[model samples]
Target chain A: MDTATVKKIAKYLHLAELEKREVPRITLQYPELSVEEAYEIQEHLVQIKLEHGHNIVGPKMGLTSQAKMKQMGVDEPIYGYVFDHMVKSGQEISLSDYIHPKVEAEIAFILGKDLEGTNVTIHQVLDATEYITPALEIIDSRYENFNFTLPDVIADNASSSGVLFGTLLQPPHKLELDLIGVTLLINGHTRDLGAGAAVLGHPAKSVAMLANMLGRRGLKLKAGQVILTGGITGAIQFEAKDTVSAKFAGIGSVDFVVKE
Target chain B: MHDLISEKAARFSAHLEQAELMGQGVEPLTSLDPQITIKEAYEVQLATIQKKLDTGRRVVGKKIGLTSIAMQKLLGVDQPDYGHLLDDMVVGNGETISFSRLLQPKVEGEIAFVLKRDLIGPNVSALDVILATDFVLPALEIVDSRVKDWQIKLQDTIADNASSGLFVLGGKPVKPTDIDLTQIGMVLYRNGEIMNTGVGAAALGNPAACVAWLANKLFEFGIILRAGEVILSGALSAAVNAEPGDHFSARLAHLGEVSVHFNPV
Candidate 1:
């Protein structure tokens, strides 16, 4: 695709988000835009935000689930950005700024050592040791009436909306993770069950992959940053006026209520 | 005479305010056609969102959808999909969502990452992921779509913000080497009863691999994952439906837990 066309598309998307309204569809009028073209537009969009006082925070990985790939009919994963404006403490959430949103259960970690650009092993992730916590993420979209495609969503930042962090816990070294269990409750009902192993068989490995992924981009995982390991239990759909909570066996739990 | 002009202006102002309010409150629109090629529609949809970012809207983070193996097969694909997040979509945990704007909204349990350094793409290794990250936390991702009943193709989901909605973050931060993530177990409790159970392996055989995949892919585009960014890897299990007054929770063995609640609209 032409650079001008890419910019035009980027410009339209920016307008639609600002209006909080959807724009009429535009025909690409060409085959798929080259990856470079797509990213060029993305870079311009990033700059536009910086000009508006929005700060860049970090990068997020998408499609970490092999199962999700099989469902999406793709073999590879995609990614997007996380800005300063979207992050929030678990206890301080406002109700008026979001559309429909849901939460997930996950294991979170902080990087204690610098993971430079290179192949990272699980052992290294463990050697960098710090502490661990639980977390919840809230997602909302900007599409008019909230409609979009996979590519559209990717370009839009993987629908990352809000996040919540939980208490920290560090188990004794050499402890077996299979002995741990998490209980998820929705509206006073048990909705799902899972363990840390559900995330690609191990959450640290997930961290390891993140380290290596960043390395290729000439980046490194710094100390004191947090990373969510992915869902351990299944997801539950939510509506206005609902209360949800998750409890980790022998650890802690996090909960919140939805308001109109 | 003077009063007449003032009255006319007042009426115009009222009308404009009403129009804007009405427009702002309208439900999200969805195509009536089921046969629309999701892939084609996604390309167009992405272009439009990019336009929004180009103008002023900010890029918040990324979201992963359908991390479950069942979902992958349901869409007749072999891998997970992704989408973007804007500054405006985030909300606190336990916040009510406007159903009117979403076709079908669901929830998932996931792990989220916050990076402390810049991460570029092109063959990023798992070690790089460890180095780039600052903290890892538990999260709940709300998957909502404008497509009726969450009906969509893989491409459709990719465009629709990866069915991204809202997320809640809680818990303490730990270093990657602090625990054995592969053997991590999770149990979900809704209200007071058990609902679901899973492990981290469900996320692309290992959530780390997912990170590796994302890094290599981004490298192809010359884009980099900067420090202090948050990434929601993907769902670890199936999606659970939620309604008002419902409470959900997920607990990870050794890591801790997270939860959210819905209230009456």
Candidate 2:
């Protein structure tokens, strides 16, 4: 696709999102474009948001799990865009604005320094992190006629939608590093549980990996920035009137009720 | 290029029809043209979606598929794939979803993350993942394929973005450092029966690691993890077949529980 065409598509995407109206039967017109190229346009569209004064937050990595890779039959991970508008407090999510919004439990890190380069290490992440917190991510896709492949989704910004954050917890540098547990509940019923080791052997290791990757790109984990560790538990579905909550063994709990 | 894509889509669609007529389980779709690599197919698909955008439908979010090792093996690949998630694809958490539009839909449990700042790649780590994240939430991925019976292969899926169909997210957020993500447990219940069980560790030996891996990988493509972007780490358990009128629920030991009801076609 030409740059002009890509930008045109991006503009249309922004228009659709801004209007919150569904476009009718788009597949017939773009039957020849491939999924990767679609993302290139989508990326351009997201960049437009940044150009338009919406702050570009951070990035989200999709297909991080091997299981997901096996299921989808791909070899690499996909990525997406994030913006300031999507951030929400643990208690601030309004059920009305979202369609099929779901949440997952995670650990978040706050950076104290810039981190970039391709050869960074876990220790570097540890040194760069200023604090840690419990969090939940709200994901909602905007595809009207939902159906896509890995490439198709990557172009869509890894299905990034919204996020909810919990209170700040003890810094990673001061914790015992073990014995931390997580519990998830729905409608006041205990549904799932797990320990901290479920994330890449240790959650900190994920930081190390991220640092290394960032280093390669002439980027660094900047001070005051945040990173969301992968889920503490698998995803759970939600229904209207159902209250969802996640509680850490030492940290506090976060909850939201479904609406509409 | 148009002719190539049209031809491929048509051929794959026909094979799927044949497979159904024979009552065979849908197998992976292969590129009859050996010259067409998965990467190339992905480019074509991207072009297709872009063309649509030129006309109308806007971009919404991205979807991560094939997050499990089993899926990788089944699809004859070693990594996960992704797909586009449109705004229209999203439904209320409790809303009933009709299976009529899906070729073969399945559900999986995952942990999703929201970014707080820009995360460019090269050497992103688990700790860095925490520092850059805004919050986390519980999620249920509804995977469907346009291909018949969801039988497309890895390359085909790569082109299709991993057969991501719909997603439902619970409304709540938590930080990455506050929870012990690795220790979290997950139970998948279908029709009130225990269908599957998993731990956060199942995702690349740890869910946080999965995010770290993704951060580093994105660096190769000159992409970065942006703040406010919601990222699904991948499925903790196997993708269970979802039928209409069937109810599915996944409960995280420490996070929370989520459920969805599917309506018949």
Q: How many angstroms is the interface RMSD of candidate 1?
A: 9.2
Worst 10 contiguous positions by lDDT, candidate 1 chain A:
A22-31
Instruction: Put down candidate 2 lDDT per residue, A191-228, tens digits, no spaces.
Output: 65555444554566666666665555455566776676
Candidate 1 regions with alpha-carbon error over 4 angstroms: A2-47, A55-57, A90-95, A144-149, A169-180, B1-265
Highest lDDT among the candidates is held by which one? 2
Kindly give the stretch of ten consecutive residues in candidate 2 chain B with the minimal lDDT sum: B16-25
lDDT of 1 by residue, A97-121 (tens): 4654556676666667776667988
Each predicted model: what fraction of the native A–B Cα contacts (within 8 Å) does it retain? 0.41, 0.15
lDDT of 2 by residue, B89-154 (tens): 676776788765555788898888778887667778888877887887778888765555665767
- Estimated TM-score for each candidate: 0.46, 0.47
- Two-chain DockQ for each candidate model: 0.15, 0.07
Model 2 misplacement above 4 A: A19-39, A90-92, A176-180, A211-219, B1-265
Question: iRMS of every model, one decimal?
Answer: 9.2, 9.5
**Where does the lowest 10-residue lDDT sum fall in candidate 1 chain B?**
B1-10
